[model samples]
Target: MQRDYFDRVHFWGRISSVTALAVMLGIPLSISLHFGIWPQAAGVLNGLLKIIPMFWSIAVIEVLTYAPLLGAGGTYLSFVTGNISNLKLPCAINAMQNAKVSPSSEEGEVISTIAVASSSITTTLIIAVGVLAFSPLLPVITAEDSAIAPAFKQVVPALFGALGAGYFSKHFKISLVPIAAGVLILLVFPALPVGTLIPVTVIISLLGAHLSYKHTQKKEKKRQNQA
Candidate 1:
């Protein structure tokens, strides 16, 4: 019997997810058993207490926000693969855009999957090559006297600047208030814990964008009425 397409995806996704989770758990479990030692209960609880309270909300928010954009396969693969924001997502989006595939369509799912796969492959190969070359390249890249080391440090900011310029140019109106708010929040509350800060910033940004969109709609309607 032919199953629905999503049913198949869901089936595979669950199997893959479970297998991956098992493998991840297996490694530490094996080590613990081999060493005849387990992590301290208090240590585990303290770590979990700090992390879960902060991260659980952010995880929920990310799942709610990104799941519709990333279909079943992409979502599953992305969760396993990580780097959704900076790498996988942008590559998938660019592939979909270049192919003129609507994100909501099956074709877009294939395109996104292919794009992320290719990106992962390329990243892996690059890392492999870097590993092979590391002994020779290490001094050149890491020496305090090496100019290249400084350049590597700047790469992240340069990337953010380029991406920020592109995004903000298009979304300046909807983004400006949130951007300002985020900066102010950071400046005023430098001690804000990461777990609290991320979700708060995201909420602020979402609210700002929504209000901006509504304001623009209202302005358009007013103009149309006057016309």
Candidate 2:
């Protein structure tokens, strides 16, 4: 029954994902057709050359990092909707925690999907409302001296800081070495671009976590033998 459930979930995930891809691709094509305008081949190639290196690498890394946390269903929805780490991940973690489920389990998958989907819905509604009121809100938010401008700039960091602190507090062993590595790298190589920094941090963090886990297991086993 569990296997069948996952099979169905994966099957539908593929279908919906493919459909979403088609729609996204179709939008650009439809706009080009309607406007009877096409970008110059050289310009298009130049643009891709500028963006593809960074964006593609980050895309691959994001998939690797997020797929496990999100599971099949939530992964599909999060990829389509975007904003995984900042929004979906924290929300899903909180949901799974509340439900007392490990993220590696089926119950975790279901609850994470529920959390991510609910977040997606709420985000969509908020965006729609924002759009409706954007004309009035825009000037106030964009003004150079706007009181709320700093809040907007700080949202992502605030969200990440809160979530990261909570998780790192719980699993400091896995996170400590990587975080230290991050600080050292930033200090030593302060000029690393945003694109390079992200994937580099992820790679370093995973390696550190893996080594830490092994050391922890060894210490625990040694303690058990001594006892």
Candidate 3:
């Protein structure tokens, strides 16, 4: 168990470290390119120099908050591992028929569940705070001219729309609430303060999700009665 824990810790630590580095490097490079801060040939080197200190600062902060970060990283790692392990379910079942113990045990289930919850809570809080705090700096980094800055602002909404579309494609019937909620938010956004937008968006999404759940439950019950 200790060995397995160590392996998982090392694996996820490396993964997060690499991901953070790539993001730190990529964002500054992209911003520099967007803003024409350097000639294309020198952009990467300049961006690297500019971003290294910022990345180091973030690393230091994460190390100081290692407890929460590790809890979250471990949760995600366990989830991914569990998913991969489950994919081998058919073979595992076949082996289990002749074996003394099953590969999928109660303890594994408990561990995965706990890891997922803890990781999710910590990671979400960290990301939410980070984004809020860093939002102002984004324009500074990415802005080339006033025109370009406004264009960059469209990226977030476009990305969100694509995500919403993917979600709707997977669950078509439940999509309308989110669509309507988004429309309402956009309609009211001009009058709303920027500070209120995030909370409003959250409320709308939550209400949409609740409505979708109730709708699905009602449909399921109707089908059951019909049967």
Candidate 4:
């Protein structure tokens, strides 16, 4: 049954990913066709040359870093719906933590998928409403001396800060290396993009967690032998 379930997931996941890619490309293609304003090959190539390396590298890194935590279904949904790091990821992680499920387990897969789906739906609805109401709210939000300007700018940082505080507080030993490395990287290479930074931090965190686990195991073994 598990095998069959996974087979189905892979089938649908691939379908969804390909379809999303097609749709994404279709929009620009359609626009060019309708306007009869196709871009020059040289211009297109130049743009791709600049962005492809950064975008493609980040794409691969995100898949590697997020797949283990999000499970198959969640990953497919997240990649399609977008906003994985800021919204879907936090939702899935919080859901799994609340449900007390391991991400590698079937139960976790279901929970993560559901969480991502919920986040996607909520985000879509919010975007739709915001679009409708944006004109009315724009003036207040964009006022030169708006009191909430700083707060608005801090939203992403606040979200990550809250999540980081919770996780780091609980797993300080394992988080130490990643946190230190992240700070050092920022200090040394302040221009590093977040797409590259995330995977590097994740790798360091994994190594730190592994070492911490091994140390605990050795201490337990020593105590058992002495007893």
TM-score of each: 0.73, 0.86, 0.33, 0.91
Give the Cα error of residue 54 in candidate 1, in Å: 3.5
TM value for model 2: 0.86
- Stretches of candidate 3 exceeding 4 Å from the true structure: 1-71, 74-153, 189-195
> lDDT score, residue 188, model 3?
67
RMSD in Å for model 4 = 1.9
Model 1 per-residue lDDT at 204: 86
Candidate 3 lDDT, 1-227, residue by residue in tens: 35576566668667876776687679868987899885565766787899798667654543443223224333334333332122222222223333433234433433433445454566567668768998887667566776567766685566456545645666676567656765687786657643234444445666777887999899999999999
Ranked by lDDT from best down, the candidates are: 4, 2, 1, 3
lDDT of 4 by residue, 1-227 (tens): 29988889999999999999999999999999999998999999998999899889888989988999999999999998888898899889988988988898989999999999999999999889877879688778768679888887788899888877878877877877888999999999999977788988988888888888999999999999999
> Candidate 4: minimum summed lDDT over ten consecutive residues — where?
135-144
Which one is best on lDDT? 4
Clashing pairs in 2: none
Given candidate 1, what's the lDDT at residue 167? 63
lDDT, residue 69, candidate 1: 64
* lDDT at 30, model 3: 99
lDDT of 1 at 49: 97
Give the candidates in order of TM-score, highest first: 4, 2, 1, 3
Q: Which of the predicted structures, 1 or 4, would earn the higher TM-score when compared with the native?
A: 4
